[model samples]
Target: MSSAPIAAAPAHILELARRVLEIEAEAVRALADRLGDDFIAAVGLVLASRGRVIVSGVGKSGHIGRKFAATLASTGTPAYFVHAAEAAHGDLGMITADDVLIALSYSGSGEELLKIVPLIKRQGARLIAITGNPDSPLAREADVHLDGAIREEACPLNLAPTASTTAALALSDALAVALLDARGFGADDFARSHPGGALGRRLLTHVSDVMRSGPAVPRVAETALLADALMEMTRAGMGMTAIIGDGDGDRIIGIYTDGDLRRSLASGCNFSTARVADVMSRGPKTIHPEALAVEAAEMMERLRISQLLVADREGRLVGALNHHDLMLAKVI
Candidate 1:
């Protein structure tokens, strides 16, 4: 049976979505031009804070406050959200005298927030306000005020908190990133904070984690014929073989790759007669087994090589890896 044809959405619906995006985008852009000393002071306060940061607000601002606190906490700063309404009902006890309070209000006059501002100040905590109306009571009472004003909401009725919420969220993210930079927070630090994600796995996974060790490592002695080395590489399916020195199978003297084979054939060298020591490239690039897989990828790219012999601190070959190994680990 044929399914009934679905009705097409009205063109006005798509137009409205575009208009909303345009207004929200403009609001976020305007925030860049408005930033100055107060924004810097807010960052400084958080950086110098001896205790955690307390973010609070009411209604839509309260929702934005929760996200703001989460972003700060995730990006090297310690912060948490405290709902303005809940603060009046004894949740305020969660706030400490050594903490910094960041209050959010579009009008700078949220009754619930205003009710607790003086009380919070009495506790010896510094107050930072994010509001649209600089002249409002919240801004007037705050130690520092960061402007979150926008021209208008994207809502046609000018009532919904569309553009305002977007502006507040953007400003909060900017603050978090600025603090992240000031604290020298790096990808490794971020990965540590998110150990369950793919990025974390890529950053934390070591060369040893994905390397082929023991019999799987394609290795041949330096005195071995090129044909024997080629056979070892073929058996291992690594496309390359390590030429080890006489002392032990661990000392990597050189390496032979398919590229080297092509070049040797072009030079009219007979693989069947040549020793691996004569054809292998000396001083092959290597990496430590303890090193991150991403670092191995970097070495491969910079040296224009496809494989690396994993070595110990003494330069003894412990394992082997190639671009394919990195690809399998999703580190490429």
Candidate 2:
């Protein structure tokens, strides 16, 4: 007997996936259209509250709820996820009367969550529910109900939660961004929340905080020979030296770099005889010591110079910063 041929997956599978995406997109669009006074009221309530936002849910909704909580917390609003199952098992203590509870349940009938509704109510925590069914227990009991109903699941079997979860995730993002805008959250606030990341370093780190200062600075008098300035640059290991005059007490006159040395030597200039003021590139690009390291990096790139002189407000040589400093600080 010939073996039965293995069945290939139907082409309808791709169509089903597209349909799921379309349905979920519609759900999110509906949410955007429905965002009238109720959404504003919800945001106002959460903003005026002195306590944190307690996001709770069960099953697939619970996973999305955790992400929402994390996004909210990172964007300036203090928030955390609480498993409804655990909340009924004494985790309810984490919620205070001043907190706002955002509960998620696609069917609006998660048993674990339903079991804790009364407890949350008794704690005086206001409830905001996202549900597919308006009449479901969770929705009926909430102070404000957000409809997350979808036409259908992406799953062919129609059993797995797919489109509903995507809609909920999108709504969560919208809520977090709205709150972030409402709070006037800026890059510095975000940097404070993410101190270990590159963006955080770029926003929070100042040039004064990382630039070499005091004795570490490579500097020479304007009257010094090019050879002497090169020696200072080498000894200091900064690849460049600032040439300053006596006026205004350390007024920068020029800057000498290793590149300048090569060009001078190639041109047959007498390095030993050429004064730093004569051989050096005059009016070198300088940055305020108080400027951001990232700004300093931009200056270096734009000027095509690897080293920059850090100066005071009055143009006095204060310190030095080079590409290496930016590399060490990870600003590059």
Candidate 3:
């Protein structure tokens, strides 16, 4: 370690940080307002292409390009990042005639990127350039140029690529989201790509995946004694039991819960003699077994209930779930 005392940040450090955020935010807002037919032309090019999108850049712009590629891939667009320097060294073979190249260079001129642009064009690949200067060589060469210019950098010295990179990243995200919408990419599509993520589980996990099924489901006939229903609830460990029609494996008509038991006790109802139907909440909220588990969780939250009965299209009880079940499944 260097034997130098660490300088403390000035008292105006908070103000400087706020100013940086303000500048970046304003830069992004300006870019958003500046967008026009050029952005559309760029989107059109990508949508028309038969191959993947290749994002290329160097330095801080490279970082933005990588993130843009990832966002595009995750949102249904097939895209990936290739370092501009690497592309010049045999990596250029990755680009094909059908591919669309998205080049990021705030200054509109990076030696490494410029070196490969001609080869990319010669290979018949279309280029979409994002730059600060509309008159730059890269912008002039691009089939479509997106002006990502900003008033100034957020850096105190105004030399760093703070606001510029932020604007590029935001612009890239805007393009990715537009592509996502244009392709009619839905939550299920997103979940398919991100199956291990929490949003994936929320979108893909069905009631059947987390619900108690078959003999595990607590069920009692409408005519069954309250004691029998309590036994079923205890056996299933779900804190509630489905009140079904008289026959075995009948359609659910109501549900009896621990809350009902408390109400029954308060009302001086005879648990020994009372029938399940008498204490059950009739026409209880039920979800289809194919319904997403997150839907059930939301329903429970909105209704201030803990448990739900999962049923088939014919309204026959097929399964059951509780807040605990959703939690265990990581669907909540």
Residue 241 deviation, candidate 3, in Å? 1.5
Error of 2 at 206 (Å): 1.1
lDDT of 2 by residue, 219-278 (tens): 889888888888898889988888889454988888888898888889999877888888
Cα misplacement distance, residue 112 of candidate 3 (Å): 1.6
lDDT of 3 by residue, 220-331 (tens): 8899999999999999999999999987457889999999999999999988998989889999999998888889999999999999999887789988999888998998
Task: Report the lDDT of model 3 for residue 46.
Answer: 93
RMSD values for the candidates in order, in angstroms, are 4.2, 3.4, 2.5
Q: Model 1 — which ten-residue stretch has the worst lDDT? A: 1-10
Candidate 1 TM-score versus the reference:
0.84
- Two-way lDDT contest, 2 vs 3, winner: 3
> What lDDT is reached at residue 244 by model 3?
92
Rank order (by lDDT, best first)? 3, 1, 2
| Model 1 residue 92 CA deviation in Å | 2.9
Candidate 3 similarity to native, TM-score: 0.89
**If scored against the real structure, what TM-score would every candidate get?**
0.84, 0.89, 0.89
Question: Model 1, range 296-328, lDDT digits (tens) per residue?
Answer: 999999999888999898878899999998998
Runs of candidate 2 with Cα error greater than 4 angstroms are: 1-23, 214-216, 246-251
Looking at model 1, residue 307 earns an lDDT score of 88
**In candidate 3, how many Å is residue 298 off?**
3.5
